[model samples]
Target: MQQSSGWRGSADIWLQAAYENLIESGVDAVRIQPLAKQLKLSRTSFYWFFKDREELLSALLAQWREKNTGNLVKQAERYGESIIESVLNVFDCWLDQDLFDTHFEFAVRSWALQSNDVKAQISEADEIRLAALRSMFLRFGFEGEAADVRARTVYLTQIGYISMKSREDLAIRMKRIPEYVRIFTGKSPEQRDLLRFYARHNYTQEPYEK
Candidate 1:
């Protein structure tokens, strides 16, 4: 059991190293020898935790789903009654300019094309996240096709912004997100402005409500 625990820890270290490297340099930059070197472990250590590079990639996809996709869905469900707040919260989570980089987006897109397994994983993760967002929109009074389209619009807008990777460009694009949301829910400009400010600044400060 102790040996199993040690192997699990090693696997986690490798996954973290791989994720960081992918975020920095793109998925093509990830390889087992380099990862082993980064972790200061023998290549044999990788075999203890994974069967091969494919297995490691699979694990990486699973981790991404758990942290990035799954957690955001959970957060949306928690705040589902307030559609604007829930959507903004998900955006705020993604606005970590340092961690969520273009390379990370590149990795996901590239892998989806190269690996059928990865494509399936990405599809499943997206469905779960989008369903959560759609449910939130429905709760806030959007109906059937309207809720679905709004949810997809918000989701795709976020992916498009991240793919662009320029803070200035994202800022310009983000300014219009509130208007889009309002179109779906009939929120007034003042209400949309409050949500927009909160999403951008990641704050719920008293000044925003006024």
Candidate 2:
């Protein structure tokens, strides 16, 4: 029995499979049998990694917190020449999948609708993200209420996009970024700063209205 449990897939593999299922079909679909069948491993292999389904779900939540909330805070804390640049740094999270997984976030949020515990975690994550953005504004000399409102504006807009599964052409989105920075930070980014931001996203040509 012990050898059977140890014979096959590793914990990461199971967890990854759980993540895929959770994102693709929601959390309820992230079961041991489905994952075992998907991985073509015996059910015993699942126990080698997780004690049960609840444990696996907890791991998924941890990963989400680490990747989504963690990256936003880090980006908000990244060195930027001005508030515009700092706002742009936060914008990178919206564009870059490696920095933030929108689909995964959406999935978890949907799961939250069905679970009180998940809903509480979602609220906690929201607070953490909002606090980070508030600090970013505060660091740039935005005073109290102004900082709070601006932070809410920035974070809520991104969350709205995620929740609604909004899509925009990359070029169109790039063209709007400067205006977004201005709106979010009350200052337009310099041409040089915009150029650097564009280059980071491999947007070579100058943005244009279409």
Candidate 3:
């Protein structure tokens, strides 16, 4: 058996390299040999922590789901004050160019299309995120069906922003989010202004179009 210390170190290196490669290229571009080469390790080192390419890929996808998607939803739940803010934060999190990028979003979406396990994992994450947003909307005063619609709209906006590649375009798109929120929540100008101020200062601009 491999020493515990050596085993963990190798696993960490492998995951870090794999995630970088996935973000730079795409899921299909991630191969065991290339990842091992990037880490200056032999293929045997990869097998020490992961049984094969499939296992490594599975772990990589799981990590992406957990860190990129799951953690955001969890944090929003913890920090958000109003239902509107909580729901808006979900979009804000996805739009964060520093934390999230077009390539990373594409990697997840592409993996979902190619792998059943990946699709299920992403679907589960989406469900949780959407549910949390929906609940936040309800708490902020939106009714049953309307909250659901607003939650879906928020999800769509995130996806839309991810499709664009320019920072300037992204900012333009983000500027419109407040309007959508106002329409969904029926907030007056004062309420809309307050929300916009909070969103602008608190969150990163949406990915693409700065």
In terms of lDDT, model 1 sits at 0.68
Q: TM per model?
A: 0.76, 0.95, 0.76
- The reply for model 1, stretches above 4 Å from the true place, is 1-9, 96-103, 169-184, 189-210
**lDDT of predicted model 2:** 0.89
**What's the TM for model 2?**
0.95
Error of 3 at 116 (Å): 2.7
10 residues in a row with least lDDT, candidate 3? 201-210
**Model 1 pairs in collision:** none
Report the candidate with higher TM-score, 2 versus 3: 2
lDDT of 3 at 38: 72
Instruction: Find the candidate with the highest TM-score and give its number.
Output: 2
Per-residue lDDT of model 2, residues 46-142, tens digit only: 8867788998899899999999999999999999879988888988999899999999999999999999999999999999999999999999899
> Can you list the residue pairs that collide in candidate 2?
none
Model 3, stretches more than 4 Å misplaced? 1-9, 79-81, 95-102, 164-174, 188-210
Against the reference, the lDDT scores of all candidates come to 0.68, 0.89, 0.66
The clash tally of candidate 2 reads 0
Using lDDT as the measure, what is the rank order of every candidate, best first?
Answer: 2, 1, 3
